[model samples]
Target: MKKIRIFIIDDHKLFVEGISSLLSDDPRFEIVGHALSGNELLSKFTELDLDIFLIDINMPEISGVELTRQIKKLNPKANILALTMYDDYSYVEKMIKSGAAGYVLKSANLSELSKAIEIVASGKKYFGEEIQEMVYNKISGKAAFDDKRPSMNELSLTKREIEILSLIVQEYTTQQIAEKLFISERTVETHRKNIFSKTKVKSAIGLSKFAFQHGIIDFK
Candidate 1:
């Protein structure tokens, strides 16, 4: 079988090692490289011809969202999946915007993780059921499930830009947003500025409120 080359970036060494071991045992996946920070991931990303990257949303230096943006810039086909413990509606919306093909919580079992990878690798979205529910509830407004918000692309934002926009709404510090998105602080700031320019908003709060009001984040 042709194995999928995978890279992982997370701050937790124990969790990284454990996940590496699990994927190593799976014939469908080949663990190529692992890093503990977004900076490390960027520095070493080119060394490994990765087919997919599993990034933790919160990191020390660069954020998963930022990193995914960089990776997408370099290789648009790179499949980035965010593996996080946060299933909050904001996080989910932002991760999708950032260029991640899917979001799977760290609390998920290995089986679910594997399924997420396979599903995303196939060019389809994979959200945990709970996460899906959260998104649906937020978008449908009354949890009626009938009137759903449009797809993330409907905003005309690129994958990475979408991710950054979502993070902006979450009130993440620039440093924290950088680490979670895997970009530098300067880049995050630049993106923030660009978001303001594009959305014609003056402040982060404006963007957040606008996103909520326009059903950009659902809660419709």
Candidate 2:
């Protein structure tokens, strides 16, 4: 049985040490490394063979959104599982847009955390029940937040672009989208940028909103 190799990045030293110790007791997990900040993690990012990254959202210098984006750019195969105290729906949407595979609240028990890790490791997205409810509520427009409306460009989504748009909203990573669509990753990226431009919504969160507004994707 292969152990799930994990790398942790959190600003709190006590949390890092505690989680590392607790994870060490689990025979299925191997905590290969940890860092106290995003910069520190980037410095040693190339040094490890990690399966899942446990990232904290509110770091001092680089926020988890940017960190997760950078990590995905650095290692497209990197599977990020956000481990943060924040339960904000916006944060969850941002992290998913930034290429994180899952989101786990810091409040999660050992069993839930382990389950989240396993789900993400198997190439599926995971979110806590509470977080899921929050996202669903926001998407259904039961909750209020500013939705960045996209400019209705003269150009509209092509059939291919719509397909990609749906997959992107579903939180499929670029690589996975490429595989599923039977296209090159570069092609998938090009289509993604085109969708962004045509919809004039750069953020995936906003793009999903655009999709929902246009009936391209159902909010439900």
Q: Model 2: per-residue lDDT, tens digit, 33-101?
A: 998888999998888897899898988789889999999999998889998767788899899999999
Worst 10 residues of 2 by lDDT: 146-155
**Can you give the lDDT of residue 201 in candidate 1?**
74
Against the hidden reference, what TM-scores do the models get?
0.62, 0.64
Score each candidate by Cα lDDT: 0.74, 0.79
lDDT winner among the candidates?
2
Worst 10 residues of 1 by lDDT: 211-220
